[model samples]
Target: MNAGKLACSLLLSLLTAQLPACSFNMNVESMLSPPRLTAEQEQIYQKLQNSVGSQQVRLKY
Candidate 1:
């Protein structure tokens, strides 16, 4: 029973240690303003917006 408990605790600790590798940090700036597009991207975006006509279109990267 004691060995089983020890093994469980070790497994839990190892999982906890690995959790940060799968975690991500949020960028407050990006959330607020988002990144700008390159010239080529801008042309494509404009084309998309134009294709949509008066309706609203949004692009996210």
Candidate 2:
């Protein structure tokens, strides 16, 4: 292969290798404002909080 083509291939392979290390989090809205729970769910959540320390539990679904 020509030098220019070989350089391009090398750069492309390097970029492709880095793809798996990249991540994109699209759940910004959910993280910013979690959904509200129903009455029964809230009761259960309170019980969980009481069982475990409040700081140790985060309901993410």
Candidate 3:
């Protein structure tokens, strides 16, 4: 490759490496919106939620 092409390619690679990568995250819209579950669903969710805690066991596949 020519010197100009090499320089351009290197500059492009450096610029791409320096740029921050985009990521998906839970935003306000998702956080604020309610799933609007029925009473029975809510009760089931509450029961299941109460059963779990911060500490969890990792089962081997």
The clash count of every prediction, one per candidate, is 0, 0, 0
Provide C-alpha RMSD values for all models, in order. 7.6, 8.2, 9.4
Best-matching candidate per TM-score: 1
Better of 1 and 2 by TM-score: 1
TM-score of each: 0.45, 0.42, 0.38
**Which parts of model 2 are misplaced by more than 4 Å?**
1-32
How displaced is residue 27 in candidate 2, in Å?
Answer: 13
Per-residue alpha-carbon lDDT of candidate 2 for residues 1-61, written as tens digits (9 for 90 to 100): 6999999999999999998896778787756966799999999989998988747887778
TM-score of 2: 0.42
lDDT of 1 by residue, 1-61 (tens): 9999999999999999988896555888756877899999899989999998999987757
Q: Which ten residues in a row have the lowest lDDT in candidate 1?
A: 22-31
Better of 1 and 2 by lDDT: 1
Which residue pairs come into collision in candidate 1? none
lDDT of each: 0.88, 0.87, 0.72
Candidate 1's C-alpha runs over 4 A off are 1-31
Ranked by lDDT, top first: 1, 2, 3
